[model samples]
Target: MDRNALLVGGAVGVVVVAAVTAVLVPGVLADPTDEGPIRPGPVDVADVSIAAGPATGETVTLGIETRIDHRGNPTQNVSVLVRAIDAESGLLATTQRVDVGNISRDGETTAATNLTVPREGGYDIEVALYREAERVDQAKRSVSGVSAIKPPYLQSTTSFTDTEALPPVSYSIEDAGEDRTTLDLTATLTNTGDEPAEDLSVTFVLRQAESNIVASRTTVDAGTISAGRTDSVDATATVPSGYNYYIDAVLMRDGVVIDTARGAANLNPTRTISVNQTTEDVELRVEDFEDDDDRTPEDYESERTRTESSAPGFGVVVALVALLATALVARRWRQ
Candidate 1:
């Protein structure tokens, strides 16, 4: 009940009230409708697919498709980065960037790009989604056996007919003599493509069955053949008689061999042989030794002896002549 004490207590109470009001008033008066800073929506790589494109000698193009899913608020300046890394070497083979622009809706958007790489090994394809130059999500896919893809130039439209029912190579004996035989070789080809096959040639090689020696070989042009059509080319070969031969047919285009087939020619009348059959040991034919003048064996031996005797030394010749004269005198004394 002192006046100064009561006044000091009142002042302390007022200061405490003011401090509580300062702390609580702003939080109570804050607007409930206010929303905080606008953040970008979530963008994710939904799916990824890859397809093979045109192929050249050692390189090929791959088409990459990336699907992005957008949720929440709209996104701006979206893009997809595709990379091809060699699986074995862990080195980057190729890369490409595709712009997807703005993605406003909450759906999927596709981004496509092409990546060219060597057609030798497998690769790991990586797709990343970027928003305003910032990466949001990424995905990966793998492909193998790239070397199985064939180039355009090496893809042949025509091939030899090889089947159990039909053979590609066949031969006919045109003429057969005592020492030689002539064959007419035919090679059948099938064009399986949509376009005509041109600039083709076939080579016929006649190899002896027993010796594997090339007896005769000939090349002939194969005319243009329509698509889905089978045609034959002909060649002639003259081989030695009394032997079996294998007729090999080689199909070529622009000097490159595309296909090959084999047939057989049985020229021997006494012994029959085939290309796939094993060869039997045969007796070799030999002739008797004779002189160029058609002399017999006895005549040759007599001539050889006479030439040897004529080359004897002078002492040997004088001894022979004296012996003959002594023999003649003894014969006369006996008479």
Candidate 2:
């Protein structure tokens, strides 16, 4: 047994030495440029910081401002991702991703990521700008500036009311069914709007590739949305096979349609929200995934199970453990 143990130890040493030699070979070592240079172009992300924002659970948003180009074009399609690490162990805790829409005409973009952080703690964020798939530029954030956050999902809106109604509308069975369909319908109405709405009637307009509707209502409603909160009537239609269709939540006031947008509902259980719908042919929205978490329950359970099962392995280690156990057996000149 001792001889076999020595042979195994020798083999382990040889393997370790070979691995070291392989790493030391020429062209094997990493280049010094592995740490890429931070060259911020016309846009500056100096203020890009991660903060716990208002989401149901532990959600985070990166806040930042951009320095515009001389032409006053804001940085388009900024991708900000945050990865939280354990300050004590330096272990990666969580990762999140967000996409900020086109920059303002003044070349300014704020740090609002679609990524949701499921847990709370210190995190490091990377702010990047991309044109297509290629990264045009990016910047890393410091952990010190990462603000701590807590819970409560509430939006303070003095202008908007909690309870509102919709206009009376009838549906034309353009095309739609359980197997194949596309529902397209239009609403006509007016509004009694007093204040401008942050989320106008356009917000209720649900346009999905699965559905197509051309709503040309003569009325612009009250102002944006408030002018057209009326009662909802059945707007049903037959959806055609493979035809694109979307549910548009409409608003009406005094029998006239005002704004569009606000009819998007995920009630069918399909994960896609048609956020790709464009205003002026551009999409400007971000959403968090339902399964996103700082640490999944399965991961936590797996770690615990491994640790618990490892107790026996420690016993094996103690058993396989090499110890110099010497015994001094004295005898009185036994013949």
Candidate 3:
């Protein structure tokens, strides 16, 4: 062959080899697997935070920042989950999921949801990325400045009962079904007093231990219970999973809570509520996941205050180090 032709042929062969290698290199290095649909890489939770929302007292907006970056294929129809957990009680207060219509090959987005803080306290805000039911990535952060409001009815005392031959109350968990994620409760209010109990309201509050937050609250009208007579009212409430819950029935008359009773029932089998849900056009409102755990708002504030106070000191140290390096360089140059 002619020398120039031979060189040109050799270059063409090298180019073909390079093209084949470029296509096969990644597969050779990657884990061997059976033939299946190609899977997208995981997304990451870059940052999580909570700030005060538009509503005052025990309501805040949880902010979750997600990052998705991969050289391979991109991900679509992914879910971003944000949960608020009480630091003290270890119970989840609320969870919100944002269905990312589609995430490009490389991008970052922030999704936020409003949640009621069970009480004024510190809380752990968790953010996670999910593909179907599988978790991709997650991150957690601490937050503070949640304010707790005391109910006007029971401000000074833990509970109250009228001394004047008050109405005797009984509470019952009529029927509880775990499959349906709901509980049915009944409250019977007896007018033991000589006079009739009028305008009575019976409320059932689902209480989780070690926290002031009520998981579910519903009211039933007792109307009027004649002397020595009883009136029964039924209440249906949706229960969240992951914690032991008991029902507290409070009998109220003319806007004042008078008699109260507590009843226990087992409902959750998995002992954890699933917070993931579908996305919507407007704000996403998650109902099942709620926050009822205990936490210390002061502790969260103290940590933030300490971090803010030390930032200036860190800057000073960095400046001093730079100055010292400059002085040493000058000395060395002179020597």
Leading candidate by lDDT: 1
lDDT of each: 0.84, 0.43, 0.62
lDDT of 1 at 139: 96
lDDT of 2 by residue, 1-335 (tens): 69999999999999998789777786565677786553333444445544444554445553434332312444455565555554546666556565655555554545554345444455555555554355656666655433334333222111222233532232344544564343444443433445433322322333443334432222222244343443222333433233233455444333334333433322233333443462222221212111235568997898898898777645665555433221122233342
Q: Using TM-score, give the best candidate's number.
A: 1
- Model 2 residue runs over 4 Å out of place are 1-42, 54-78, 100-104, 114-121, 143-335
Q: For model 3, how does the per-residue alpha-carbon lDDT over 19-59 read when each residue is reduced to its tens digit?
A: 79868785643446656687675566666655554443334
Candidate 1, 140-246: lDDT as tens digits: 99999888676777678798898756678888889987767788888889999999999999999887777677778899999999999999998888877777778
Clash count for each candidate, listed in order shown: 0, 49, 8
Candidate 2 colliding pairs, count: 49
As a whole number from 0 to 100, the lDDT of residue 34 in candidate 1 is 71
